[model samples]
Target: MSNKNINRLFEALTPTTEQNEKMFQNILAQSQNENTRRRGFAPVKRARSVVLAAVLMVCLTTTAFAAAYTGLDKTFLKFLSPVNNEQAEYLSNGAYMVDKQVANENGSLTIKQVIGDSNLTYILMNFTAPEGTVLNAARYRFGDSMITTDQDYQSIGFKVLDDGNPVDNKISLVMNIMTKNSIAGQTVNFRFKDLQAADPLPGIFETVIPGSWETAFKLDFKEYSNLYQIDQNITMFGYEALLNTISVSPISISLKIQSRSLKEINEAAGRLKEIGQNKYSDNYPITINYKDGSSETTSIFTGLHLLDYLNDQMLTIKTFEHVINDKEIASIVFFDKEIALN
Candidate 1:
């Protein structure tokens, strides 16, 4: 997309001062917390063969959490959710790198790693079996001693290797675990109960949950300090849009934007819920450069919500995809100009 078009899309997200500050503080706290952490998961339980989905969390040291997939598939690793180059850096640098491989009769379960800020956590896993072993389905969940507000957290989610593609001996899995209610600083719990696998490919053959494959452990809510910012105000196509805050994460930017209005600001927004989180497909401008020397520009925005308070029409925005290449972003091109942030 043209720089002008991209900026126009990004300039739409505008958040209020309080909202901006809160977002900034939360990010800072997560980044600062990264400095204080130990990397090792204490396994609570072990399930057997083709059925090893549940993994409990335990605390451990960094030396014990090393990468083991050196000989494994790099192509598959890169494709796993949240395990891009930047995320790999995050795992090697600080996040607990769980490299425990539990053996099974027909295959094995490798708990790759787990990384978490105060708000969200991601788990990486790999399931390897005999060439013909058909790993069908799995379900898991995350819990803590303290439960955050229902709205603050999301249910555990997982994505298996190839998803709809055919099965293979070695496959990868990624998860998105959300949390709130002070879950960041505290040890969290997990469970992976049901795991099913079929044999000799899919047909009239019966499916079995395998002998066992459940585990438990605690994840040290290690803090991460990987946030960068680019604060500026610019006039795009005559309208003044303030780039109030640009928060960086392992793979993306946590952005906040705002514009001024004397009235209640988009009254249509007030009738519904949240800020710019509706079907109002408005375009904005943004450019991001990754540490890998790659960059992208897009006017597409998601994870957006419009929050209106008083006369302020603020919009919260984050990148629609894993646009940040470097764990530390190199630059952000805005207003048709190359600008370095962080």
Candidate 2:
């Protein structure tokens, strides 16, 4: 599509201020309802058909974008929002580098790594996983994690692999286990390879449980950091969250680069800028896949800024799909863009 047209598409996807408030309220209500239901109270029942019908009405009212397909026969509604504007310089060597440090009340972790090729534009993250006693065959809910998207996190699973076997040693299997209840019993060992790249980013990486369960099960990182010895924790969440976070992070970084190629970047930037301008309806959505077998569809509004970062660069997005045993599952997409550093 022409850059101008793409820009308009993006603008349409940006949600209005009022819409944002409404969405926030809806989320709060949903959470409260879930809490109530978990307490053995009769849950409030809203008409599913009515809700679906209303979402359909919203979808039909907007012409900018429509749901191409709602997988799993689920009702899908778009919640779109525009991102902030920023600029960054593109490295010619096909690599970009990123390093981040995250701290919580209990402890902290630092991530340093090259994302792109070492000889090209490279990005990297370095972080040490907390070590603790392993809880075997433990299952935890992820609905309470601090994530930004609407996708369900319950579908994601994490396991500790030792010689290809699921192990209960939490400290040693840092890269494979997803959540932990307590760090008191056993230690596990894990390497970076055990962490599949499909693992979600760090922002939404929080322990999952109900308030009571969380209160009873959660352990402070400080309590186990010294006693547990694990090299890496490869935690994976729902496929959608993992893909969305990865795309958003690098795209946000690219926009922060300083460069003189406005004309080239503008081509891509215009598409994003148009979204900011509200040229189209707020229902357009886009799907992203990763190099691993994971895919997610996010509202176009959420990804518009990433387009602006690319501009006129030769970029290709490829999705990798994989299946194990007979189940068709897992996929990831790689975003490849060519830039002239000199």
Candidate 3:
């Protein structure tokens, strides 16, 4: 078949919005069922396991959409759906690629590319196990926590690389980190302690392989990101917040804001706190508006209260979902206010 025909076939197999949501709910359910085992570790692994299972199932049922994204180095394709031309155009601009490798007795890991801004860092890598080990459908559970040089940044989780069919003794993965400060020109040390591979089970992930993978690399955030100073203030949840900075990259956008009135502990200390219900407002919506009259929004906000007793200042970081061309943005709408960017 011709390349154009092949692309059409893959696009046809792509899941719709409802189908994607159903798959997401299934992944969530699987993760919840195994929450007992995922308490101490990061919540990303459970999600990854279910995603791997779902992807496997989809590949088996649908012809082979993975083949469409074979040579593309962008890791975003692995997570986002409907690999259409528009999505490809968003990531068409090449990233600063890296070819660093680290190995030990168990296996060798090669860092393919590094992309990020000050607020987030994404590492694209592939791992190759020793002769006897088979890594097909393998997921790792870390014994100790994954740490970085900057105490402010923490590893969110691992994203499995999509390579159509699982290759024997080989697996691709993406390491994502949420940063409290800029990681530009900073060396990050990664230690995957007591690494154990999960057995090829249906839902639950049982450890079968035991080992560790360690590597360190420096990040040049300036190479991939553009930092913009927004010194704007907006009020939300009955409190005022100062939008300090916004950083943009090819893969994501990160925002940092501060609020002095947002107290760490409210006076309603007697009642049990409600979960998943934002009573102050229906939802704290953060949107990124593009010049073309389109926008993207995310409600997930990470708020860190600092010096509550002394100054009562709260710091929050919001990471947007869509990959964008930073230069094309017209403004950013925080709640009701739209702060113009250009």
lDDT winner: 3
For residues 1-342, write the lDDT of model 1, one tens digit per residue.
Answer: 233432332332334456555655555455445434544342324212111221111111211232321212332234423334335444345456567676667556677766554334556777666667655543322222222333433445555554344544565676655432214444443434334433332322232434334454556535443444445675444555566555555433444445564132344323332335323333444677767787776554444444455435454444333324445567876554455765
Q: How do the candidates rank by TM-score, highest first?
A: 3, 1, 2
Candidate 3 per-residue C-alpha lDDT over 171-190 given as tens digits, one digit per residue, 9 for 90 to 100: 77777666666576778777
In candidate 1, which residue ranges exceed 4 Å CA deviation?
A: 1-76, 80-90, 98-112, 116-120, 126-133, 136-157, 162-171, 178-184, 190-217, 221-225, 229-242, 258-285, 289-294, 299-323, 327-330, 333-339
**Per-residue lDDT over 1-342 for candidate 2, one digit per residue giving the tens place of the 0 to 100 score:** 233433444455555667755755576566567667787544346434444455555545542232221110010001001111111111111221123454443223332222121011111222233345233332322232231112221112232222222343221111112111112222222112222222222223334211211111111111111011212212112111111212122221111222335344344334433443333321223344443456554333421222223432211221111111111212222222211111
Q: What is the lDDT of residue 85 in candidate 3?
A: 56
Cα deviation at 216, candidate 2, in Å, is 32
lDDT of each: 0.46, 0.26, 0.58
Q: Looking at model 2, how many pairs of residues clash?
A: 60
After superposing candidate 3 on the true structure, give the runs of residues whose Cα lies further than 4 Å from its correct spot. Answer: 1-97, 138-145, 196-205, 221-223, 264-283, 300-315, 320-322
Tell me which residue pairs clash in candidate 3: none
2 or 3: which has the higher lDDT?
3
Error of 2 at 24 (Å): 68
Candidate 2 lDDT score at position 239 = 13
| After superposition, candidate 2 runs with Cα above 4 Å error | 1-92, 114-317, 321-342
